[model samples]
Target: MENSQNQKQYWKENIRLLFILLSIWFLVSFGAGILWVEELNAIRLGGFKLGFWFAQQGSIYVFVILIFIYVKLMNKLDKKYGYDD
Candidate 1:
């Protein structure tokens, strides 16, 4: 029973983490790509329009930063939950 419960908890945590990461990914991609493009387009960075910047470069940078942040945060979360391997 204890082992089964632990397994379930592990799966739950994994699923939760996946969902959070996916949501962030979608926000950076689709959200910025479509939903927020107009607002972002008003701002400029160097020669690029903001929406174009995000659609082209900004999202990639944000994705990389997010990956590192996720790794660091997940490490902390793993340690907290005694799930670090």
Candidate 2:
């Protein structure tokens, strides 16, 4: 029973992490790229419009970075739950 409860808690935390990460990805990809493109376009980055950059390369870069962050967070979570082996 205790093991089952532990598993439930672990799964809950994992889902929470996934939700948070995915929300960030969605906000960056959809919000900045599409919704706020005009506002972002007013700013320049590396000779490119910030909005265009986010639409093209920025989201991809952020996704990759988020992947790394998720991995690191999951590692810590695993250790916390005694699943790091």
Candidate 3:
């Protein structure tokens, strides 16, 4: 019973983290890439429009960084829950 409860808590934390991470990903990819594009386009990045940069390259870069951040966060959470592997 205790073990089951621990498992539930671990999963809940894991899912919460996942949602937070994905939300950031969406905001960067969709919100920055499309929604606020025009406003972003007013800014320039190395001769390229900021909006275009995010749509083409910035979002992907952020996503890749997010992957490593997710891994690091999960590892810490796992250790905290005594579920390290």
Candidate 4:
């Protein structure tokens, strides 16, 4: 039925968006927060240290902002892809 096809398209779009969002999340959190922490630590943002901020707070804020950005972008993408309901 048309409904089932629409549901499948929705799921596909969601999966694609999820992967992209999670990849960015991992890169910012793990890569910037842990792996490259030392190099980043040398850099400073105002009074707070870069590495510490990324690990403790910055990554989380980035993730939240990214979620909103993803939603906005995905909505536009879905419309362009003809996947919007």
Candidate 5:
């Protein structure tokens, strides 16, 4: 019974992290890149437009950062739950 509870808790943590990461990804890729694009374009990033940068490169960068973040977070969570090797 305790083992089952532990498993459930671990799964819950995983799902929660997944949700949080995906939300950020969506916000960056869709929200900044498309939804607020016109407003963002008004600002310049170096020589590039903010909206164009986000749509072309920023989202990809954010996704890479999110991957690292997920790995780091899951490692911490694993250690906390005695799941780490």
Candidate 6:
């Protein structure tokens, strides 16, 4: 019974982490790239319009970074839950 509860808590935390990371990815990719593109376009980065850069490349870069972050976070979470090898 205690083990069952622990598993539930661990699963809950894992889901929570997933939600947070995915939310950030969505906001960066969809919000900045599409919804706020015009506002972002006013700024420049590396000679390219910030909005255009986000639409074309920034989101991908952010996603990749988020992947690494998720992996690191999950590793910690696993260790905490005694799931790590």
Tens digits of per-residue lDDT for model 4 on 1-85?
9878877887787788889889889988998899999999999999877988899999999999998998898898778658779
For all candidates in order, the CA lDDT equals: 0.83, 0.95, 0.95, 0.87, 0.95, 0.94
- The weakest ten consecutive residues by lDDT in model 5 span 76-85
lDDT (Cα, tens digit) per residue for candidate 3, span 1-85? 9999999999999999999999999988999899998999999999889998999999999999999999999999999899997
**lDDT by residue (tens digit), candidate 1, 1-85:** 9868877886788789879887988888888866899898998888988888888888898899888978987887777667788
lDDT of 6 at 33: 97
Ranked by lDDT from best down, the candidates are: 3, 5, 2, 6, 4, 1
Superposition error at 36 for model 5 (Å): 1.8
Per-residue error (Å), model 3, residue 13: 1.0
lDDT of model 4, residue 15:
87
Off by over 4 Å in 3: none
lDDT of 5 by residue, 1-85 (tens): 9988888999899999999999999999999999999999999999999998999999999999999999999999998888988
What tens digits encode model 2's per-residue C-alpha lDDT throughout 1-85? 9988989999999999999999999988998999999999999997999999999999999999999999999999999889988
Q: What is the lDDT of residue 20 in candidate 6?
A: 96
In TM-score terms, which candidate is top? 6
> Which residue runs of candidate 4 sit more than 4 Å off their true CA positions?
1-20
Clashes per candidate, residues 3 or more apart or on different chains: 0, 0, 0, 0, 0, 0
lDDT of 6 at 48: 94
